[model samples]
Target: MSQKIGILTSGGDSPGLNAAIRGVGKSARGAYGMEVIGFRDGFRGLVEDRTVTLGGGALSGILTLGGTILGTSRDKPHKMPVGGEVRDMTDAIVETYRRHQLDALVCLGGGGTQKNALQLHQKGLRVLTLPKTIDNDVAMTDTTFGFDTALGIATDAIDRLHSTAHSHHRIIVVEVMGHRAGWLTLGAGIAGGADVILIPEIPYSVQTVADAIQERVRSGKPFSIVAVAEGAVTRDEHTAMAAALQRRETASSKEERKKAKAWIQRLEEESTDHTLRLAHQLESLTDLEARVTILGHLQRGGTPSAADRLLSTRLGTACADLIEQGVGGVMVAARGEGVEAVPLEEVAGQKKLVPADHPWIDSARRVGTSFGD
Candidate 1:
């Protein structure tokens, strides 16, 4: 008998997930003649044994769909809400896997999904993952599937914001989505020709941003568009964050480490409306009217771009091929024009941050864009 394959999506929903699912399911069922089982709501569904058999009909015409067909959730295997309390359901998940006779489990998601898939891989089950995040911060891949669509949405928002900024002669601070990495903000900022761009990768100063706007005003440009990543922080805040992380990473005692970890989580939770605060600060410093427009979920809701569709299809088909061979513990990573199966160990729990000297940053600098550094 042919092997039975399982698939699930985890973490935040992204554009092109359906396309990836279709790519994998169609190939697995049609070409390789495998029985495809789709677990719903991520790891939670696996623990609860909720699934749908994905035949060719179920996978058809979903290439342009926006979300996963099997559905998705943020539940982790080790700590998901079971009844009223959190519980470790890894053994339950393994039981489900064994009961279903799955030859391999395919996971589609971002960085966190990769980590969770790694946990499953360690449990001695065959596992494969696909990179799927708008942040494009999954380590080892050229770019994740949803990033192109999100980037285009953010760029279009910035393009639209330019007209209002020009009309009001105001400093319009347009915040883009990116929790830790600034790929979305930086890309849209450059593409939209913003006067100033602030990203989380580089620490920035509000005063520097204000001074740049003032310079633009003196040079006959009355309006300024400041593109900021949601997670971008002031230089001083970045300094404190670095110190806290160092403490957490180098604590001499378990109690000290726990305290530092708590502090770090607190710092992250307090970052709400950071863009609004920056806008007000710039208004005071530059003596200009300032407005804030946060592009929140607008970035995450959209039709997948042509590039994203192509990438998802490519990675998805590659996943099916690997599953046919019973390969496991690897993420199907996009490398140049082709795909490569990277070991999950190299991808799990790792972040692909923008380097200081990345070409994108250099180009932005050479074109006279201010990073507010």
Candidate 2:
């Protein structure tokens, strides 16, 4: 009998998910003569026992398509909503795995998915994972599969906004997605020629940004572009956040810890609209008409770019090879022009944040770009 492998895409959807599924399904069936099974809506499907058998026809003509066909969700195998309450669903999932007799389970998703996969592995299920977030924050991978496509999309949006910013002599604040890390915003801002690029890694100041805009105006440039990560906080906010986290970490009681955690979460939620406030601050300080354009989920949609498709296919094929060899508890990560399997323990709960002195930051600084530092 052929070896059996089950796969699922979890967490937020990205552009290259479909191509990845096609790559894994085709290669598993054709190259290794393995049986491919897909779980629907991530761990929820595994708990509810919903699945589909993959054949060659189902995997056809899907390389350029966007999103996952099997669908996805953020449900965790250990704690899932059941009967109107969150309950442990691991036993149910493990039973489903036994019924299907899968030799290996391949999970394709971002950081949270890696954590979930690690838990499943601890439950004695063989698990392999693929990095699939546009954030490119997954550690151990040179870059995630969906990041290239989203970067292109975000860069194009920034490129198209230059004309309006120039025409109206407006300071355009463009918000791109990146909460804990700034890879997406940094890449797009540099590629799009943003005048002031503010990232989460480098705390920014509204006054510093205004100064840069004023300097641009002094240089006969009437307009400016500020590409900011959604999570980019001002220096003041960053200090406040550090204090809040310290309070949380040092809380002596569970109640105090809970309150601190809630306060921190509220702060993060409020920070979601940071761009709008930034625009107003710029307008007030620079005396220029400032506008905020939030890219939001637009960066996650559309067809996968050529680079993303190639990356997903390569990772997918590598995943299949690993599955055939009974490899588990690892993530198929993209290295430089090659693929490698990194232990889930090393990947989970880790982030690949941009360093202060990264080459990209150096290049941006040398180009006379302002980081609002």
TM-score for each model: 0.98, 0.98
What local distance difference test score does each model get? 0.92, 0.93
In model 1, the runs with Cα more than 4 Å from the true position are none
TM-score of 2: 0.98
Error of 1 at 200 (Å): 0.8
Candidate 1, residues 110-197, lDDT tens digits: the string is 9999989999899998999999999999999999999999999999888999999999999999999878998998999999998999
Best model number under TM-score: 2
> Model 2 residue 4 lDDT?
91
Clashes of each: 0, 0
RMSD of each: 1.1, 0.9
Q: List model 2 lDDT by residue over 207-277, tens digit each.
A: 99999999999999999999999889999989989998999999999999999999899888888778898
